[model samples]
Target: MCPVQLDGIGPLARFSRRSFLRYSAAASVVASVPILTEAHLARAQRNTLPKNIPPGAVRIDANENPLGPCSGACSTISGLIPEGGRYDFDLTEKLEKTFCEMEGFKPGYVMAYAGSSEPLHYTVLAFTSKDRPYVTADPGYEAGMYAAKVNGAKVLMVPLTKDYAHDVKAMVAADPNAGVFYICNPNNPTGTITKYEDIEYAVANKPKGSVVLIDEAYIHFSDASPSFDLVKADKDVIILRTFSKLYGMAGVRCGLAIGRPDLLAKLQLYGMNPLPIMAVAAATTSLQVQELVPQRKKINADIRQETFEWLAASNYKFTPSQTNCFMLDTGRSGKEVLAAMQKKNVYIGRVWPSWPTYVRITVGSHTDMEKFRAAYTDVMNSSTAGLEPMPLPRRLRETPFTHLS
Candidate 1:
């Protein structure tokens, strides 16, 4: 990875001397031999929610694929039934190899989780302390910040660039105790990508012991490739991955993280769980179809572009995106739009207090986007839209925002 140089102008100049030192420390640890341990997870009883509940309402809320596992993955999952109670390290091993190849990294650099959120939480639990801090883009992903906050770590919130991509220099400058520097590529709500080099600099110039965690959950739909080279080069950086998106396997629970052996070892404080036979079977099958992503990327992109185009023609403002989703600037109360859509049987994504005029919209199938368009039109054009608006509870609201934009 091309490490970011800390001595710079514009944003970096804002980092206090203490903050610069903190960023340096973060970079050192990530670049060093293993020092951090993965924290342990207190296992909870298995979630028994039904797997295939139909979306009765036209739902474009979650960034989930409306259509589920591809035929190859579906068949493999069904085949795993016979060994439902068994543990197959062989299957897991193969899956790891597949993951390594796909990311252009090695097996040792890769680790598995039930979902990307698991590792996201563990990274916080393992690293943050009263003296250390958690730094991330405001109005980005929420799960990581909560983990850090509950762990008693200070949280440093950085604003995004005017264009919506992460302000990498600000993130790097907010160093010192910055335990983990987070960049959610094609960010969660906005779906914008910071240039690969900017992220590289943040990782390279961050505090020596600090870790840079890139949440690439939307990478499949995003045009940018993740920085696995940093892992291959043995730099202290973690790239998170998930099958939850493209594979439609959120219910099955599978995620991966890649970094140098030492950086990954930090997460080892949390012991590994025996592979779920079904998850392994399906994930392996999903990884086998290397071409499946490119094929679907185009289809998803076409749908996303069509929706954005319509929005543009209608004078709706949205964060220009390079992934399967984007944030729509409703030019009014997003909560108002949300309630209106809900009443019309269309529920889009979450709201951000930071951008009260914006609401996130996942790129669903063509028909679902059409449903959202109609509902949105009705809501915006109706008189009831003037009613008082309600927001998501604290947790949901906080996760999707850093500060008012």
Candidate 2:
């Protein structure tokens, strides 16, 4: 990724070195809030009895892998419990090495985190500021927007193309002083893939000293090619990978940020905690399972396609998706449909302001999707007037930019 040189006279320069230091320190503390986790995001979206999620609720809201950790990963986690008292640094090293080998990346090009969100946030904080605006697709993942707001950076939300893919050209033209162009491939909420050519164009044409942050959190669930080759080419790009999706370790929390060592070094300014030993062990074992990705990909794809077909036959409008999640355009306010589904005990995902009528749906297992289909049909067939509007929690409503899938 391109190193953001702070030599010019703008926000980075005007903000004194001492002030920047204080800001970084304060932001680090803020970023550590536990509510930023994936699970908490679902709770924030629903604004219901979050602390007491119903026991038998068919929860397809979070885009979590319903299969959970594989047998091997479970066995690994169980075996590693006794050794959890001490940090297994080698396990972390082994995971990094194995991932690098699997992807043909150099050793220092990767660093592990609890989840990709940390690095994602850090990258935005490191590169963006008032002068250097953050550019992202409209209705895209909002974590980067949250980081941008934290850094006092302007956010330029570019609308996606007609097919719901990232409008790379429009993104490049969004702002000349753009510091980071955030792309979530098999993008969250929509689950649509932006073409590789579009990504390469963004990387090739982005402003000088700017970086393209590509989040591949759901890459495994789709057939689209990854952008790791851009890293190998030493282009200005940082690619994020997470075991939270197909590997089924959302709660376990293990992820990677791949880029040049210099780019990775910039993210360290925000400070990072030591790797969790249990997560490291589980992730290491998960990476070695030969058939895990292919097997899970087929399962998720099958269910997602089936759901799409049902929606099409029922005359419901939806975004055709490649990943485990897709957006459905309710004929009325998305919040009404969300509440209706909640009443039916089939919890779905949140809505983006850009698409007020579209509610995201996470493709769960066969039975979970079936429950979703029934609840969705019932909600769509009924009038939305009687559905109570469940506003987001106070904090989230106050800062609507923090809404992420």
Candidate 3:
């Protein structure tokens, strides 16, 4: 089928900043904070990110694993590359059943999506409505609110607790009829976790019919999470997983959604995604080789802890992150700091306005961190270069590289 026709879009469906913006603009229902000017955006639009750029620009903005994929997964994808013409049933079934076994989840309770994003977007579209608003933490996962807006559901953005974790009580109090209550554990940008018991308490008392989606996308890299026992017991909760972060399968794109059979079944309304043979092969192999994830998780934790030590010694006020990324208070415009870092070929994450003075940086390799530290020192020391350049985070659609669990 012609994909463009399916989106009711023309030949311009390719992924450039402008095309992506055009398609997403019509669907924005949530009131967004505008910050960038036409002139500023025009520069980014006109720039093609110099092709010969070096790899020194470590990408922490998108929360990607610096490790790309494990050896077995690499082999699997390499095996599948030449077979693009074939259906990927065997590999997909192997993945589904193996994931169920490994995760201690039932195969029936699981469904695979190329990435967690489509399922996130699809799940909201399938269940939410004008009367049943979508409730989430402000500065939490923007994807959920974006999904709710596409469906014309009211978005209630509750503020985070002073400690920077999701205010479970406040979120529960926001909208009783909420169709989807989203909590990103070890919440993004902040890198702090909300206890599993807290989530269970909220889930137990959630609006009688609403679904609680606990995104443990970063859980593998952290300590234990609220277990998948809820999904096993047929509770009204869904857990999302991806092979991106530690397993290094960001580009391979394999993600899973676990919940009660009925709620998982509701996903049928959106129809099945044709699992790419390549992704299926890579993800399935990644799951079978579980040691790789644990090893990488430890590496990420070690790197993160070391960085925290430095932050502490330097008297940097930063959020405590058990995961792979954390926010640092730059004491100034984070956007300008981000740009400054970029100019030095060390792209830290964007400036999150929730703490306008803070900057979020994804935990990169020790080598990358050293470069980042050097770049940061240079930027701070440069005479009269302390001001942050404001950026208008364009209302772009979700990252096309969405399997980012």
Candidate 4:
């Protein structure tokens, strides 16, 4: 990892003399800085619900692929169980090789992890500090912000554009000495795509030495193009990918961080360990199935669209989402509606503070969504006069369910 250096007009210039010294000291031993731990992964990925949910509940709360892994991946995982005794680091290398070849990325440019959350946290920890703030969209994914908190970095939240896209221009201006500008394409909660031009603008115009981190965890579910060219050009950019979404490997846990070798090396400053061997085999086999991405994309798109159409026809308000999840505006407090839905055995996503009346809903299987439609309609029509809003302190508190937020 490259150490921070003092220059006349460099990134450290914005810091006071004392702050700069502290940041430099922090950077010197960054490898020892603890960030989000194993427990954080679950919170970053989904809003936790009650543990006693019936097994048959329509679980559309977490943005998981109900389709599970493809047949090939399942078979590969099953066949590899006996070999689990060994670390089988070779399997990880093969998986990385398979992905690098397919994506046209140089071998060193991509680092595999158990899930995207680890790299996401590491990237934030490596880039942001007390001197350099972490810039992100309000009501966006909160995992990076959690890392920023640990690093003592100020988290500057730029509100989304009127259409719910990341306000890249606003983000660029949010902190002149920003360390990492994060954009989650087809943004979470809203699931709306920021224009590719806007992303390019952030890259070209961002402060020198600052990295533009793009979390493309939902890219496969949308028609949005990947930002591989930015990494290829050796720009200060990092792209995060995960099998947890469209690959239906949320439980399997395989992901990648793609960027210039120097940029990726910074993330390695935290730590690197052997990935789950079964995850590697499953991811490798999944990649070989030529039809996987498109087929699963279609499945998610179809189900999401069907849900959107129902919401529209029923005159309910919702964002025009292109991914497997979308924000739904409940005429009342979203927290109330979410609880009511849960009572009906339909668990949905949590509400973002910026959009208190908007509850996020993950697109589940056709049958799951059908139940959601019925339960949602019933909840909206029924009385919730005494259903109080989630308290501010509780909403922002660091719980196992909401630590990321």
Q: By lDDT, who's the top model here?
A: 2
Q: What's the distance in Å from true for residue 348, model 3?
A: 1.2
Tens digits of per-residue lDDT for model 4 on 1-405? 122233333433576676467555646655444444322332332323434447888878778888899999999989989988889878888888888899897778888898898888888888888899899997888768767876778888888888889889888988789999999997986899998889999999999889999999999989887898999999999999998899999889989899988788667646557788999889989889999999988888888888888889999999989999999999888878877776787878877777889988989999999999999888888986665533434324552222112
TM-score of 2: 0.91
Worst lDDT 10-window in candidate 2: 1-10
Question: What is the TM-score of each predicted model, taking all chains together?
Answer: 0.83, 0.91, 0.82, 0.87
Scored by TM-score, the top model is 2
lDDT of each: 0.72, 0.83, 0.70, 0.80
The CA-based lDDT of model 4 is what?
A: 0.80
Candidate 2 residue-wise lDDT, 1-405, digit = tens: 122333333333566677577657756645653325456667776646544458788888888999999999999999988987897677888898888999898878888888898898888888998899898888888777766776778888888888999999988988899899999998887989899999999999999999999999999999888999999999989999999999999989999999998898778656556788989889989989999999999999889889888989988899988998999989789888888888888888888888999998998989998888888788778876767555666545554342212
Off by over 4 Å in 1: 1-55, 384-405
lDDT of 1 by residue, 364-393 (tens): 888888888888888778754554444333
Which of candidates 3 and 4 reaches a greater lDDT?
4
Question: 362, model 4: CA deviation in Å?
Answer: 0.4
Residue 153 shift from truth in candidate 2, angstroms: 0.5
